[model samples]
Target: MSLDRHILSFLRALVSSRERKVATAGVVIGILYLLNWSQRKTSAKISLGHRSKKSNKGTVDLEFFKRIIELIKIVVPSWRSLEMFNLVLLSALLIARTLLSISISSVNGRIVKAIVTRDFNLFMKRIIQLAMFAIPASMVNSGLDYLNHKLAIQFRAKMAYYLNQKYLTGLIYYQMSNLDNRIANPDQRFTQDIDKWASCLSNLYSNITKPCLDIFLFSRKLSDLVGAEGPIFIIGWYFLSGIIIKFITPPFGLLTAQEQQNEGLYRACQSDLVNHSEEIAFYRGNDWEKRRINNTLDKIVKHINDILTKRFFMGTFDSMLVKYGATMTSYGVLGLPVFGPNREKYFARIGNDPSSITRDYIRNSSLLINLAKAIGRLVVSYKDLQSLAGYTTLIHEAKVVLEDLANGKYQRTMMEGAVYDQKSRGTYIIADYIKFENVPVVSPNGDLLIERLSFTIKPGMHTFIQGPNGCGKSSLFRILGELWPLFSGTVYKPPMEQLFYIPQRPYLPHGSLREQIIYPHSREQMEKLGYNDEYLENLMRIVRLEDIIEKRGGFEQVEDWNDTLSGGQKQKVAMCRLLYHKPKFAILDECTSAVSMDVEGSIYQHYKDNGITLITVSHRESLLKYHNHILKFDGEGGWNFYTILPDS
Candidate 1:
């Protein structure tokens, strides 16, 4: 009978609240329409559990947060001098906001009390108090929001800096791409995902902590007015709504992670198309590329649609359970002051007559409703919680992988057995030869590329390496540069500072022509090293590239060098950069492939004239004349080294 009475009271409350009826009807209609539309759609499954198996396994589990907490310990100190101060200030601001929220609710209740009692003096006094209280409340809230965003930005910059340092340290980035690749689109993770993670995480701090604080403070204030029943009933309902919402909310974390992964794949595919646009155009493969891109897009759209469907159902339940549901619950509980067995006791505590008691009931009920609404908003933000979890997982996993690579925990096996000779001390630094002592080179995945090879490049010796494609001609250079690990035996080369690498497709960074010539080094560094474009122009003239620079006005014109220069012209700029650095040993791996033979010859001759020991990897027979020795691979893990005859 008691349960029946409670149910009857709840229904009566809902009927009396006109806004509740309208909102409930709208939500019900929207949910039904969506369900019908979803049934008609064939792209998504009705069941939330029917997600991709890969997404389930790869999605960041709760353990990811444990790891993130550990990583936070490492990154938080990166705030330097503001570390403890930032924490203290943020805590204080959040507390201030929570207290202000409670004060606002109290003021609102007081205003209701004043109006219902028909006390004009009390009404004006409360209004004045509210006005004065609102100024500092608004200011504090603004400061809290500002500090929140500032802290998030600072955290992102610190974490990004750490990731950059780890990624760029000692060819770990190369190994991650080639050898121990565990994550896709690491670039995207660094550029886009980290920022999202920071924002979500910052917002999550407030969303979670503030609600907890409000529940405590508001419940205490409510207990004094309606005794224990009102606060207890509201609290229990909030938790019950949360449990029901959680049961219906899909695996949004997994779906969001899958969505981000698909986005990365699409971006990677688009980048490939841009990089290889000319080749695809030449082959007239536009349709094939479009189909490939569309396939990736299809996956993205499917995931997004699934997420929306889940949100629709969840949002409907949340609205019905939180908005109207809270109103009904609050009315049933707060109605005690008017109709409960303890009504006389409640009125006696306020020491008021019927009209004054009625006014007190209005003020107290309004405060109860306000508190319930605040808790409802918190409960309804389950989607935001899921997004936060997804981002946290990605960032945590990426941070772990990056830190592992940086710490040498995920090192390649080839690096374990290789030897580095440090015989030359600091005095004169005389190790100037390149020696391959019975060396075996293997691909990143342990596929043998070369076996038991031995050769040496004497000082001032120009060598040409020849082989069929995928026969490890370029792999040899990777080994020599220590970018790839040696499979077996030893590779002895001059210190990295004295060596340089030039690949087939040169990378033209976004900067001025002068910066291009002195890439990876600023103009200030060039000036400090006593090098400048005045001498670089003469080297370009030797390679027949001076006219190209002159045509562009001068050497310091800032532009997107990659888009501005042709393949051959880009190769010429690379040669100019090579000359500017002028290392003792230059590894040219088809670096002049786009240039004409005569221009290539001129570039090679210039290296020869400068006494730069050249190790060239190319298929051009014409290059044989520029080299003093030939190291030829037989494409079967065997190679032969011989001096080039003067005629041959």
Candidate 2:
């Protein structure tokens, strides 16, 4: 027999006699028990797979819930907070909406009964009641949507605030980017992934919570109208169908995570192109970039197509069982009270009246339909939940890494044959003068550039450092600036505020020219220091950039200074910034490499006249006249420090 026919035959046999009814109930209970056991076993396996720290991307198991709970704490911090109030109000609204639905269903049956019996007055009364309900019904639905989106925005805001705090706190951003290898694109996680996670969380809350409330309320009302067995059979049928669908469902969570990863890669590729457009154009690497971009796109397309195929088949099966099959089951349940052998029991209340029978059937059928819809939504939420798990995994991984970095813990994939010196940790101290006592210059990736080095720059001592390329010149500055971790030996330096560093390629922020000159400072701070725009203008003249202020529309005008200024102009602007800060010591790492020779000489003389000691890194012999001492690296893990002869 076909499935529907078999189901009908079984339903008929179930209510035929007391003995058959008992036997059928036992069989159903046993089958449900077995299915429940099997489902638990499957869930256990899924949980085990997802709990694996190395491969825990897409699985929805206990670990997924754990991550969700942890993130929830961040989004909704306190019970008395606004988020909690909104949640409670939203829950109340959902409950009110469900109750309104039940009332509407009853009114619908009454209207149908009045029409069949030709009672115009009764029909009109029910119609007016429904019209009155329309206002609150609309309000409830609109409120749900408004509150859901508001909560999502709040969640996103809270999460972003917390993450930005961690990201910008004390060189964590630099350490995360340079010292960690776990998160490939933290930028994507911070912006896109967090937004998605917040939205999914808000929608999932309503989707799952409302359905659960519906199931409970609808099942109770259904039992009252159609006897206990009627609701039990329907609920049991849906339960079995849920188990079947769970087993056949695809790993959508894993697929979603993979899709997001590919998207991040593609975005990163485009960012790289933008950042290096000039270099790429000079090399004519357009074809190479296109191939790489297309490769990433292909991966995303393939992943989405795979998900679509699985969803198609899964949706087909889901509709067959949850929708049409439920309709068939409703017919059987409806007949149990009116047409079964126990019809005599309901005859007095229903009273052999066709109108009464029709009314009960309509009302009972509406309840069953609503119940089926609620259960169907619960089943469908499984897929959404899986997608949420994917987002949760991504966000949780990033949070873990940030926390690890904050705790001074890091993990990096070291270069081949690079030995990390675990026992030789360097010490840092604050002093009036700068000194490095047997400090090793080590790169972030465990490359030891200078095995041991000693140097000192006391007050009035202008020291010059020269090294071949990759001979730890930049590495030393990174260590001094606390961008890289100190690895070995004792290093003493003035407070960070007393030391200023100017790199070869200056970083011009997207702001007014004034902000560029006093970067790491605000316009208000510049004013409080007894300086004004005229003082800034004088600093500009000293760096031979006197015309740039008027050329770029004054100091208050904002532009992309990096693109607007020429290379030589950019270096001059950097020099102007150094002159503005006027720190006791300045580390000039090729900062004047792009300036004219005369301009560079005058810049060094200006620093000498101001009594700002300089630690200059340059290969230009012309700068040797301004420095009293030299620290030279030979590129073979060696260095020397000595006085520079006045003539040399």
Candidate 3:
């Protein structure tokens, strides 16, 4: 129920809200011009890339907010003659507007008639008009496009705002730290997934409006051309075309989706190649990486080849339909009308103007030819767009996955007014993140790290979990902190705000030294946290980082701290942050391996003095003396968590 509600909430956020429904109104405007593709006239317009006003474009840029005002002015009863004036203006524009729709059958007849009579001059004129018809159509299309675009942006921005709010709303992030297995990478969902969603939404909004416009406009044009006969012929042809399109469309859309997946996989491999570049170089694994990359490329190539083969065959068939459909329909439909029979035959006193017969013949024949080509091309283009939209649905699906992740997560309630204590079965607990029952974690790929385990921790407690490399020390820390979920277990934890976990290689966010320490806090928060200039300076001095503090501008924020700080400095910076946060509990995952033992011992002593519980991961016996509890993991598989006994 929560997940369903989350999805509903996400969709609601995407479609509209009270404050921004005005922008979503643009979607309604786009539908107005979406039907017809080709027009006979051209006008000034703004391209999406530039969005600047142009003299040649015919479409009006109806800013969403501006349109509301214009609408209000028209409908108001007290607005003297405003509505009347708008109607007059609209009517004038409609009457002045030149519409040109050339039917496929009519153009075919004209070409046949022209060819039969060898009247090349007349044929050329019709062809020229047909060529220029798209300009006006495009302008009207562009106007509608602008409206749809505004709506898409509004929807995207609104959804992004809401999704972010929900994802970052509470201690969901804290509880989720323990349940990583339950959730995928949230970052990927936020960045890549959101982009796909926006793009898909834009395309979907355009398509819904476009097809309805096409059906209405095309039906109208056909009806006007041949009266009863035209509508029947056009509708019948469309039905037949749709059936054929259904069969051909699926393969291309499927192929496109496969291509996307293959591409993403290839990119992921490349990323791994880049991330471990130093390792590969030092171990002479260049050849190995190269071979792996080549293998991936080869696999992708085969899939693409299969897709291309199907695409080419389908393209050939579609082209055949369009090319011959234009040629045959133009001759039979238009030529038969103009040059069917002599209308002035057996007329004795009729005005014998040969030019009259010729003019009528030319007009009827030529217009049919132009209309035929224009309408045929439009149908083909529409088919291509439809197929592409179908394929993009997968992209939309991927986007929704992220949206779901962002909204759906487990909520943790901290035990209020409660403190933790160390236990015999604890993996490592000098402080909070005490585990009562921990089941082994079995990944989908069948990798097992830890078995059923249990433990506890308390404030002001100092403990250490020691094991050989990769015996799951860090993994245990993660599970205890509730960042990595045990396949099955319940973990009791203090309020998240009261605890902090420090990694082996602490991450430096893109910010200054002070910002790094008080990370994710705003500029105003620095002062609120009792972090004055003198305090910052003294902290740096204590960490032996006075030179960097002085050099990098005190409290004046560096843009990128990761590149600026060295390994030792970053660790010390993390410690400084630990001191600053003054959390009751802290987890150190080999956090001081880079620093000297003297420095490490002093930091531990400082934490003890401050009455802060310290959980340290280190190989140094010198450090273990400070920790009263020893949770030792045997290198093979078994482990023991017990109080340290001082013995000879």
TM-score of each: 0.85, 0.89, 0.66
**lDDT by residue (tens digit), candidate 3, 1-648:** 344575588678866766357655754543432221111001111111142222111121233224323322322334344434433443332222223333433444555556666779978976765566557656545555554455445444644565566556543454433433332334444455445445544554345434444445545554444344543444455446545544443234334444555665667678878877768889999888889888889879987886565555546546555555445554444433333333224122225544433443454445443344444544455444434433334333333333444554332332343222111122332334555566453322234555655666666457787889877777766555545434455666666768888887887877666788776667588788667868867766666677886688676767677667778888998888887777888888888878888888788888888888777888778888788887787866677878774321
Return the lDDT, model 1, position 10.
Answer: 76
Model 2 over residues 1-648: C-alpha lDDT tens digits? 455676698778767868886777867985775565456445645654644446667678999999999999999999999999999999999999899989888888888899899999999999999899999999999999999999999989989999999999998998888878788888998999999989999999999999899989988998887778888888888898899888777677877887888899999999999999999999999999999989988988886886786677677668878998888888889987766556787888777888878888888888888888888898878989989999999989889999998888888766677656423468899998899998888877788888888988887788889889999988988988878778878889999989999988999999999999999999899999999999999999998899988877898999998889999999999999989998889999988888889999999899988979989999789898899998889999989999875421
lDDT of 3 at 544: 68
Error of 1 at 613 (Å): 1.3
Give stretches of model 2 more than 4 Å off. 1-53, 421-424, 645-648
Sort by TM-score, top down from the best: 2, 1, 3
Quantify all predictions' global Cα lDDT against the true fold.
0.75, 0.86, 0.55
User: Which model scores highest in TM-score?
Assistant: 2
